[model samples]
Structures are given as C-alpha cells and as structure tokens.
Target: MENKEIILNILHEIKNGNIPVHTDYNLNLDMWADLIEYMHDRTYIADVTIYWFGDDDTYNDERVHSVNLTKVRLTTFGERFLTEEMN
Candidate 1:
C-alpha cells in the first residue's frame, strides 16, 4: 500500500487512543516505521499522548501521540489529511 493510505489508517487508531498490541499489526512489515516517521514530520499531530497510569506500574511510559482524526477538529493538518485537500 502507498504511504498516504497507510497513514490515514494509522491516524484512525491514534485519535481513539486504542492502539492494539503489536500482534495486531505486522512487526516485520515493511514501511510501518517509515509511515510513523513520515507522519511524525509531515503531520501536525497533537502531542497528546496517552499513558497507562495505573497503580501497578512505575517503570515504562506507554505514551503515544495523536495522528488520526476523522472529525478534523484541531488544526489544519488534520483537516487537510481528512479532506485530502490540495493547496
């Protein structure tokens, strides 16, 4: 699949804060990380990270940023991505 398609899919998950386990996706899949890096730079994703702040943990920070948003409520990037608008 092309980068744009993959990016849109990933964005869908990010907004919901419902990231599944790595098993849900191909760990060895090609261009997955590339998609992330590309989104990291090209998109204006809110730094809105989700954390697992339960009482039984004090080690790792399960943090992630927002990327996919169907409603396009925040900024121009989400709007552009959702609408696929051109300049």
Candidate 2:
C-alpha cells in the first residue's frame, strides 16, 4: 500500500485500539517519521514523539528520528482526518 494509505490504516487501527508492532528495527521508519511530522504539524496527533535519541551507538544515523507507534494514538483531529479526509 502507499504511504498515505499505510498511515491512514495505522491511524484507523489505533482508533480501534489495535497496536501495531514491528520486529524489525527499520520497519517503515522513514514513513513513520513523515507521518509523525505531518500529524504533529497539523495537530492531528498529540503526545506522540518524533525524536532522535542522541545516542550515536544506538541510532547510528544522526538524521534518523525514532517514533514508537505503539505509544501513539489518534487525536480528535486525527480521527476527523481519517473519517473525513481519508475515507
């Protein structure tokens, strides 16, 4: 699926109380970063973090920001985005 679709799917799942888990370290990391940024920028999702751990040994790439999808949930705007804009 496309990145947009994937993001919506993740949000839908989150809205329905499903937790998405990835065994791989880099599972959709780039896409997650973008989604996190987009949602935060638009105030769609709150209390979610897109952060660099600042530990080079753990996250070798300084450019890579980490997002824990399981720790994030859909905000009111995010729900509206999914139902109104994404449906």
Candidate 3:
C-alpha cells in the first residue's frame, strides 16, 4: 500500500483498538522511518495532535534499536477525520 494509505490504516487500527492505546506504541522502523514523519507532518497540518514521540531517554534506550517508541491516540479532530473524511 502507499505510505498515506498505510498511515491511515495504522491510525484507523488504533482508533478501533486493534492497536494498543495510551501506552507506548512500538513501530517497525523499516516501515516507519520513511513514512511516519510524513504522516505526522500531515496530522500537524490538519491541526490535530494524534501522536507524541517519546522523550530522549526512551529514544536512547539500548533495548530498541531501530524502532521508534511513540504514544498514539485519536484526538477529537482525528476521530472526526476517521469517521468523515477517511470513509
């Protein structure tokens, strides 16, 4: 799938509780490195805060090598986008 579609699918899955919520969400770097930043940039332009990157400490941890640790959740605008525009 295209990067945009993949990102929307990821967000949709999170909204549906298919992906974990509130807690730190682990990403597959091979899949994330190139696309996630693009997705997040779109979300920023949309004026909705849907994700928060973990702090430096978490990012620097040795356990996780390539995968980024982030917290993902739907905001009010995000929910609306999921239900209205995306569908």
For each of the candidates, give the backbone clash count.
Answer: 1, 0, 0
State the C-alpha lDDT per candidate.
0.46, 0.66, 0.49
> Across residues 1-87, which tens digit of lDDT does each residue of candidate 3 receive?
554556667667767656422222344543454354455565621322233355356564323233332445566665766677586
Tell me the lDDT of candidate 3: 0.49
Extract clashing residue pairs from model 2: none
Rank candidates by TM-score, best first.
2, 3, 1
Per-model TM values vs. the true structure: 0.44, 0.64, 0.46
Candidate structures ordered by lDDT, highest first: 2, 3, 1
lDDT for model 2: 0.66
- Candidate 2 positional error at 83, Å: 1.3
**Ten residues in a row with the worst lDDT in model 2?**
19-28
Model 1 global lDDT (CA atoms, 0 to 1) = 0.46
lDDT of 1 by residue, 47-68 (tens): 4322233324674643333323
Evaluate residue 80 in candidate 3 and report its C-alpha lDDT on the 0 to 100 scale: 69
Query: In model 2, where do residues sit more than 4 Å from their true spots?
Result: 21-27, 53-61
- Candidate 3 C-alpha error for residue 23, in Å: 19
